[model samples]
Target: MEIELKPINIIFIAFCNNPKCKNTISIDVEEDTPKDDEITITCEECGNSIRISYEVDTI
Candidate 1:
């Protein structure tokens, strides 16, 4: 017997906190999700981390 799983969709928004480096970064869920329901991404320019929430929907 084999089991199948459904796919989940999520969106992510990243932004820098530093006043000098106010860069923006965005990404979409592709293969898998983060370790927890919440994700934290760091800014490449200023090394600032931003926390984001993830949500899944079923159709």
Candidate 2:
């Protein structure tokens, strides 16, 4: 039997509005597939929830 694999290409970046809280998160997903539609990011420091859509490249 033979098998093939595909490279995973997914990049993520987090941006916070609060200047006092310097929290910028970045994540890279290295899997066989990319993200479907959107990605969610949660802030550990401020407890903030941010939903990022695939359409929006810049955050």
Candidate 3:
């Protein structure tokens, strides 16, 4: 038996960890981007930044 699978798009929302800043960042991953890619974003309201990593696995 054989199985077929497809890649999926992922959306990530990151919030500023700073107590004084109240901002949220949205990141979108499409078919053009790799499944296991890393992203870095900075807060608009403040100077805070964060790094996000994605890893896909099958079971």
Candidate 4:
């Protein structure tokens, strides 16, 4: 048996944890697959750090 794989595009939305900032960021994932379950990013507006985590379940 063989499996075919293709590139996937995903949109990840995250918001800054800072109560005063509350900046929202949209991340576009393309060209390659994510290697980690967590993504860390900094807010451009307030320079606040944010982390986005996701869980994968197999069927």
Candidate-wise lDDT, in order: 0.71, 0.67, 0.83, 0.73
Backbone N/Cα/C clashes per model = 0, 0, 0, 0
Kindly indicate the candidate among 1 and 2 with the higher lDDT: 1
By lDDT: ranked, best first: 3, 4, 1, 2
- Judge candidate 4 against the unseen true structure and give its global Cα lDDT, from 0 to 1: 0.73
Per-residue lDDT of candidate 2, residues 1-59 (tens digit): 87675555677888865666779877665564344576767877787777877642332
lDDT of 1: 0.71
Q: How far is candidate 2 from the true structure (C-alpha RMSD, Å)?
A: 6.1
Flag regions of model 1 displaced more than 4 Å: 1-11, 34-36
Better of 1 and 4 by lDDT: 4
Task: Let me know the TM-score candidate 1 reaches against the reference structure.
Answer: 0.61
Q: TM-score of every model? A: 0.61, 0.57, 0.72, 0.66
Worst 10 residues of 2 by lDDT: 50-59
Candidate RMSDs in Å, in order, are 4.1, 6.1, 1.9, 2.7
Which residue pairs in candidate 2 have backbone atoms (N, alpha carbon, C) closer than 3 angstroms, thus clashing? none
How does residue 49 of candidate 2 score in lDDT? 77
Candidate 1 residue 7 Cα shift, in angstroms, is 2.1
lDDT of 4 by residue, 1-59 (tens): 98776555677888778889868888875546554577777899998877778654433
TM-score of 2: 0.57
- Best-performing candidate as measured by lDDT: 3
Worst lDDT run of 10 residues, candidate 3, spans: 28-37
